[model samples]
Target: MRLSTVILPVRRWSEGGRDQWLRAESLGFHTAYTYDHLSWRSFREKTWFGAVPTLTAAAAVTSRLRLGTLVTSPNFRHPVTLAKELITLDDVSGGRVTLGIGAGGNGFDATTLGQEPWTPRERADHFGEFVPLLDRLLSEDSVSYDGTHYSAVEARNIPGCVQRPRLPFAVAATGPRGLKLAARHGQAWVTTGDPKLFEAGTPEQSLEAIAGQIGKLGAACEEIGRDVEELDKILLTGFTPDRGRPLESLDAFVDFAGRHFVLGITEIVVHAPIADSDFAADEKVFEQIATEGLAQLAG
Candidate 1:
């Protein structure tokens, strides 16, 4: 599987954001991404640490790595305004941005921000219409269209998105309907979890289950005439391990997770130890595993 880079817990690790982002380039990660946060407003906040500016700063410093908000919910951003920001960032990244979008999920994001959340059905419907509007605004000069949730007059957006007509649009999905919706609209899917979540079986069997579910998603894409192979379906297995083990156990987990990740996603971003753990043994174990694992895999 391809190895993409990620920066996680962005909500908590705001201080080290740029320094570590610059560090990822040397670590041989293909992309640097962070989760979107719009809520949890403390008494004070800085705007630069938010998702888009973080990406912009990362883009300015790095020449090779890709950049994007791992995702930002559309509910937080109106389509036209988001399209503008994405276009500007795409220019900054020189077309390396992967614009991941979704219907709102966390109620904290909505209720706390006073941005009323949508039902699952509403999210699905909004998701369907969201991408098409993005497609229209970025590519066409005039987008005179109307949908249940949004409408746009036949007006041109000056200086549209950077990656040609259809930029890299990924859907953040977990459930069946969401997956199907991802197939129909997303150029890729972003998922996060640990590999132990799967069953005990041959790696091939595990891969088959993942591929089967993805095949269903791909079939849905086929109905819409989008090529399945072209889509970058990826698993975000943040391989969070507990303690030290022999190289054999670490190797097995890394390779096994890599196989399933390949079957499911175009890339896998290893979730390494964060170094603030209580037990030094656990830290050492996961560090040994991640270090050896990346050494072998990146090789």
Candidate 2:
């Protein structure tokens, strides 16, 4: 299985951000992603940076380390503008960009733009519209569309993306509607286990939940006559009941990864160590995992 890391954009590049990204590349991470948000929870009071700009800087400094947002959402983004930025980012990164997108939750981003948080149904509807429109905006030179939640009138993205039709999309979804969208448009699928199990569920329960979600994803692909294996199944760690267990040691991580790999997971993403934070971990062990975890798993 491929191993990757998520470096939260909570530091200024000159201060320490640049080193984290450079280290990720040197350690052979498959991709180093960041949370795409104006300000994430808890980090709201910290030195959070914008995702695109941070990624652009990272792209300038690193080679062979793919970069992307753990997720970008329609919470405060318009497809037309986002497409333009992504096209440029793809070029900047030399076609090493994957868009991990989702139907945003009712978090700080939901109301930071002076709008009420969307209901579950409304979020689903907006996401359904957003993904397709963004797809067209990136693939075609010009696009014009009208929908309940978004519109694009003669929008132009000339020269398009460096990744053929467009860069790859890693759709983050667990629900039926969202999974259907992922099956239809994604090159990969992402999940952080189940949120309901984050606080009170056991690791075993989390495993079962993820297995069910994968089964649904497979069914969704089958419905469209697409092979489920065509899409990489990625598990972004730290949100499940297992939380930091997988990163406790090389053996712990290998065991954790092996269990999920058996369930058809092709990629596992862990958070880069952050001292005294929710994502806090031993930097040495993290680097070790980055360097040797996959090889050990293979052995």
Candidate 3:
């Protein structure tokens, strides 16, 4: 399985965030990601940077490692605007950008943007239009679309993406509707296991449950006549202390990745520890994890 690291822009100066991602690339990570949130919860009181610019800066600094947002939703972004930004990022990264998208959630982003509270079904409906229109706008020369939530009038995509047929999409999905959407449009499907299970269970249990989610994704693909193996599987953990702490130990991490690899996970994206203070300490801990983790994999 490929391995990735997510260096959050939370509480880090732009330079520190860029440095951490650079460090991740030096340590042999396959891809580097930053969280795409507008003032993430609790951390709202702290410094949080925008995902697009941070990723743009990251692309400028790193040459080999692929860069992207952990997942960007349609919460505060229109597909047309996002498509333009993504193409620019892809060009800057030399065609090394992956778009990780989701149905979005009710968080600080929604409220801050003055968006109405949307039900899960409504979000799914919005995504149904969002993905396809974005795909067309990126791939076609001039497109016109009138959808329920989004619209484009003869949109021009001049000097198209660095990657032909647009950039790769790593769609995040857990529910059936979302899974079907990902199967239809994504190059990869990303999940974080079952939230209920992860909250009350041990690390082993959470990791074990991911296989079930993979199975559900396969079923989703089958219903849509899409080949399951054609899509990459990515897991995003390390948000909670319980989820993040297990990977601190080298052996635990190797086994963690190995177990998911067996379940058909193509990549594991672990988040860097929140840098409330002592950024150096957080960096050191991640350095050890990445160093030993790669060594273990190589062995």
- Cα RMSDs, all models: 5.0, 0.6, 2.3
Question: Which residue segments of model 3 deviate by more than 4 Å?
Answer: 11-15, 239-242, 277-282
Error of 2 at 131 (Å): 0.3
lDDT of 3 by residue, 121-239 (tens): 88898888898888888888888989889999988888889999889999999888888888898999998777776556776677667777888899999998989999999988653
Error of 2 at 284 (Å): 0.6
Residue-by-residue lDDT tens digits, candidate 2, 1-299: 89999999988888999999999999999999999998988888889899999999999999899998889999999999999999999999999999999999999999998999999999999999999999999999999998999999999999999998899999999999999999999999999999999999999999999999999999999999999999999999999999999889999999999999989999999999889898899989998999999999999
lDDT of 1 at 30: 69
For all candidates, the clash counts are: 3, 0, 0
Task: Looking at model 1, report the run of 10 residues with the lowest lDDT sum.
Answer: 238-247
Candidate 1 lDDT over residue span 1-299, tens digit each: 55565565443344775667666776666676766666433312433246777777788888888876667776666676677777778888889888777666645565655656777777777777777787677776567777787788775676776777756877777566767768766778866432453434443454555676677777777777888787786665532231222223567656655566556566665443344432123434444554465566555
lDDT of 1: 0.64
Could you tell me which residue pairs clash in candidate 2?
A: none
Query: Relative to the unseen true structure, what is the C-alpha lDDT of residue 27 in candidate 2, on a scale of 0 to 100?
Result: 96
- Full-model lDDT for every candidate: 0.64, 0.95, 0.81
- Give TM per candidate: 0.77, 0.99, 0.92
Superposition error at 272 for model 3 (Å): 1.9
Candidate 2 at residue 155, lDDT?
A: 99
Residue runs of model 2 more than 4 Å from their true location after superposition: none
In terms of lDDT, the best-performing candidate is 2
Report the number of the highest-TM-score candidate.
2
